[model samples]
Target chain A: MGETIDLKLHVWRQSGPNAPGRFEDYTHYAKAIPTHASFLEFLDIVNERLILAGIEPIAFDHDCREGICGMCGVVINGRPHGPRKATTTCQLHMRHFRNGEEIWVEPWRAKAFPIVKDLIVDRSAFDRIIQAGGYITARVGSAPDANAILIPKQVAEEAMDAAACIGCGACVAACPNGSASLFVAAKLGHFNSLPQGKPELDRRVLGMVTQHEKEGFGGCSNHYLCEAACPKEISVKWIAKMNRDFIRASLRYAPPVERKEGYG
Target chain B: MASSQVLSFTRTAIGQKALVAVTGIILYGFAFFHALGNLQVFLGREAFNQYAEMLQSMPKLVWATRLVLLVALITHVVLVVRLARRAREAKPAHYRFEERMDPSEGILRRYARQTMLLSGLIILAYIVFHLMHLTVGAVPGLFFVRGMAYENLIYGMRTPWVAGFYLFANLLLGLHLYHGCRALFQTLGLRHPQWDRRSFAMALSITAVIVGTNVIIPIAGLTRLVGGELPEDPQEVLRTGEEKHTVSE
Candidate 1:
């Protein structure tokens, strides 16, 4: 597919969200692209040309050329990066493109994720969810020394598996509902399987879900699309776990009643 | 070490999850019960309407519950916000992300970040409109009537927009619960290799059932697909083996 794909690109051109936003179209000049060139590499060629022409290079989110850092996220032709499995935009190579293709690249379009620039957004809503639904409350010294807790090997591996999320906004960009359950759940699973994260487990789950809802992410439709789009393949299982924790906590919880001490 | 000076590191991937677990459970649990409770409208106006009346009557319980929920909600948001901020802060500039795992990636076991976000957002919108249309009417002394949930339910359904939204949201909820319940089990360390397949299927089916049936109910009412006097038992149709399976994941 390295045929120097002939295509029209509908790129999101917003000076800022408050500023006007428009879709600028450009035709490919047919630069001989390597089939192995990652998608971003292809963009680099375009950016170089724009710079030479004294144009502001297109701004999109990307970091750690490797996929782990979770910096690069964009909707390419309505898909979060070109269609691929367990891969992010940075890892996406050029081979997926055909000789002639009309591609659309846009920043994550969601209410909560307002655009900061061309493709950057104030994705602090994700931060908001983390602040509420994250963490197993532990007093530093209270945690046992590293080896003191012998968690089963499988549990550790699974927890590590959940911990692999890179905080990319692809799920929001790809989700029809713009949900963020996967991101929140991964954080939930990583700590809930261990002893150190137990004391405040109930409180943590309750807090995160509340915050997640406030941020305006859509609900999961059980379509498994988010799992499919996920770069890290973080799993819906953690979310399920989050649900369970909330239920159990609810059953056991007795709302703290603020009394009017002087009179009822 | 002075407790005040101690830098209580608030954000980490592990910590983030603990928060998700707690919050996800509460939200999903509430939704499941709410869906189940709302369907009681078909049990005839008297029974269903009375239920709402009863819940409204307990001001103390309701107040206490709301207070506690507000606090818990605040705490959850605090944790998520801190972690997300740090993650963003750690990256002074935009970075790229890609998936590396292939055949090894478990369907239900991976992709937690995106899924959680999607569900959280959808549920949020649903909650707002839901409370506005359903609960607020009664509390604000708006158009709500005593012992008239059936009439209210039908009237709301008659609006193509409301029915359409309810149907759409329920479907999304189903998709959400499918993996959510299973993920919950895994996070709690309850998954077994031998039964994983069975569990996943079970989880998927439960979400499908809840979302599917709930959507159909609204559509049926709106479209006149199934019309008759109120049924003797509404929740009976929903009785399933999966009720226990819904306990997170």
Candidate 2:
């Protein structure tokens, strides 16, 4: 049996989007939590106790509970996903904490990401950025034969590294300026590194970068806090790549000239 | 059509970042060469005054260089101010319990990175004061005589308050350069993963050289290490300057 430890949790509470929020002390209910329990599980225990006492339970976002879905995240003790490197909040276990320790939890803070409820933020801004140009145009036919593209091993590995980003928004939370450069760069790298994604490389970079700026995300000053806060360990190198590509595309990619007269 | 394309390009955030990087390079080059040129003060009155006269002889070249530096300085300041505003807007709210993820990072790196704007503004103010004190010789109470470069420098730096201001301003400039030198590469999309360490080393060396020479000049004057003896009359200093110029010619 795992050792059970008591904890003091100061969870952020917000009734609605427009409501004022504060950290509500949960010391009375968060007692005897198993050390093996994940952070979400610990929250569940606290919620269950609140529900039994005829009080409204805490509301937070979670899915899959395995850190793959990128849906669960919260700032704990001022760091996104707590202090463990490359571990999401859902995978953070209570064993990492000592008995009777106090944890302060808050939601991701950024102008682009608006608060929807307690511990849940409106992340539709990410969707808008992706919609701008996060994909390549492909034919709607039967699947192509395997290994036809013939991507080199190194290139494929690098693309896979960029693809490891889970869109968790932890990078935004961790950045002092709340910049989303890492997330946008990872997406650009994932697509631009592949042969199939090369045809629209210039357009993709240009569109996505402009969209990111339009969404109120800050520019990258290379502080690299995003790399440190990333649960997927996405490197800031992708941002450098994005920057290189953007400069090249802005210079060389000319817009199509307008015709003065139409075909008769 | 071409002009329109250029206009549209500059409107993007990346475009402004590229401009900032390019202008920063120009300013850095000016700082480096300016520091090296000013180091002639250590060689004593004749060498230093001759160097100043040589620069004054080429009026066209001096004005052209000044114009370029003026443009670069203005562009750098304006773009950085706009970028900083955008960054502030991006994060309208603050986290109540925010902490640095990596406490192991050096305090200098943290302080320099986070306070770029603050250091930059202070350095800009210093530049204005510096131009007034040395270049234009318009500061009241400081001894000034036209073309007496060596005497002006020695007399100006000997004052305790002026020397102290120079020391403080140069230290802030050092901090600004420490981050600016490294960030320019990233801004221009020139940084590669393999060259990260080398780039940092390059930035450190450049900042050290520029700051070292600039900081020492004032200290040299303050401690009487340089500037042996100044003639009481301004006309006497001018006579010596012209004599050296004629001899060199």
Candidate 3:
């Protein structure tokens, strides 16, 4: 004996970013869905029904079908990842919703993220930001012995906290200012705070921030919507750390190769 | 070479924000000291005039300081306007039903964020008007004299509308400074949880101290606590070298 909720969906439909977009209404039948079903699972049932009815399934991006992938995202009822705190769309369950509720679903809307089709959006802008300076340039070799390098436990924890960013673009999607400062800061903090990643710190920050601006992402004014919308609950402190490191790198850094060869 | 690197750094978003933070620090220092200096009025007319004269005596230093402030102000305003425009263009479509992404943020933080641009513009307008009334002696009045800054301040505040506007402007300035400090510390990477535990308190207290002193001067003048009975023509007082006018209070 399971409970089911009949519902209506007003989902945005679009062919591409350049094409016109509109919300198409769909009504779910009185079939009782399992009360324990996840929101995605509910969507899966609706999509199945649509396909069987000779209609195209809603296009959305999801992988791993879990919260970790950071691939699944949609603005449900005018909220990024639905009306939940620190929860991603894939992790959201159907039990959170009331029966006969009309859920409005739309893709993440930003100049940097263009809608592809239905709820899917182009997030390659985030990939470009990562490619700019997201990785440490350390030489690849057999895994170094743990504890070979002594890093302060607190520093390591902070770096790990910053590195938890999944590049979901939720920060960008959720920010009222559409600022990517949080994302850029996360990438910068993950590396700048680490010893192995220290050498190219200045260049990495400069490249990523330049790339972020080029991607048309807005600047952060400490509105902190990203922190609230984050599935990982990444703190705005990392952004502050990034700003500090960026300023230092901008002012004091000289490429290691440019150091004096021999001082007389 | 470092200067050149700094110049190049100023081209990015973080760089622009760092400029705002740095300039904001300078502006904060100026406002804090300016409020402290203006509070000399409560010590009576002689003390305030001596303070004004001391500042005016160092013409070169005063001019240099003014020029630096002008440059910093322009840079802060320009960069902020440009960034605000960029933020506006970032999201063309509006969310129909907006929900609080973070409900934990207090009302002060919300007020600071939403009112930043508006308060900044209002403060800018106030600065220009204030300069006209006192600094430039350009505002047509019987009391605005280039060297008589104390009298100018008192006379300006004697008008209820002017005094009221000053009070309101300083209140907005308090709001701006409160948020500006919080944002600056974050932007400059100066925040540490140990010290940041009191960041809100620090910001609020600093704003209150500065704006509190500033708002007092106009209130004092409007209520006739200082320089209440000065005649329209002060030739007799000037001839007698009684520049230090009597204070009833």
Best by lDDT: 2
When summed lDDT is taken over every stretch of 10 residues in candidate 3 chain B, the lowest stretch is B1-10
Docking class of 2: acceptable
Best by TM-score: 2
lDDT of 1 at A77: 64
Best by DockQ: 2
Q: Model 2: per-residue lDDT, tens digit, A83-141?
A: 89999999999999999999988999898888899899988888877887788788879
lDDT (0-100) at residue A36 of candidate 1? Answer: 79
lDDT of 2 by residue, B1-249 (tens): 122323346776778888988998899988999999998998888899899999999999999999999999999899888888888898887777755678777889788888889999989999999999889999999878777788999888888899888998898889888888888788788888789899889878878989998899889888878885865455676788789889999
True contacts kept of each: 0.03, 0.63, 0.63
lDDT (10s digit) by residue, model 1, range B75-188? 655655555554343323221222332345566445543455565567658767767776565424223433455655665665677888888777666656665676555544
Enumerate clash totals for all models, in the order shown: 103, 0, 1
Candidate 1 residue A127 Cα shift, in angstroms, is 2.2
TM-score against truth, every candidate:
0.53, 0.93, 0.89
- Candidate 2 pairs with clashing backbones: none
